[model samples]
Target: MGEAIIFKLHLVLGTTIFLLFPFTRLVHIFSGVAAPVKYILRRGYQIVRKRT
Candidate 1:
């Protein structure tokens, strides 16, 4: 119920999510990269083709 306890809980959960994000099926993690890369490569339209 204290501020310190809340901080600790957030730190723990954030660390866990950061550690697991890259190794799992949740690769929207890379959408951050895709957006910029799409601008340079002009590949924005290819996302659908690549997925199918």
Candidate 2:
């Protein structure tokens, strides 16, 4: 009985975190995953000039 209660609590907390993940700072995970793709498709580097 105790194990079943703990299992249910674990599932509830896991589902809550999954639902809230995208609304939290945790959403940055998607950005981090896409960064490499973005960099690969980005335009050429900017040219810099030295000031006299």
Each prediction's RMSD over C-alphas, in Å, is 7.4, 7.7
Predicted candidate 1 versus true structure: per-residue lDDT over 1-52, tens digit per residue? 4579889999999999999888874654357867655555663444344555
Error of 2 at 7 (Å): 0.6
TM-score of candidate 2 relative to the true fold: 0.50
Tens digits of per-residue lDDT for model 2 on 1-52?
2568889999999999999887875454466778767766778778999999
Off by over 4 Å in 2: 1-3, 33-52
Q: TM-score of every model?
A: 0.46, 0.50
Q: What is the Cα-based lDDT of residue 17 in candidate 2?
A: 92
Per-residue error for 3 in candidate 2, Å, reads 7.1
Clashing pairs in 2: none
lDDT of 1: 0.71
Which lDDT value does model 1 have at 35? 62
For model 1, how big is the CA root-mean-square deviation?
A: 7.4
Residue 33 lDDT, candidate 1, scale 0-100: 60
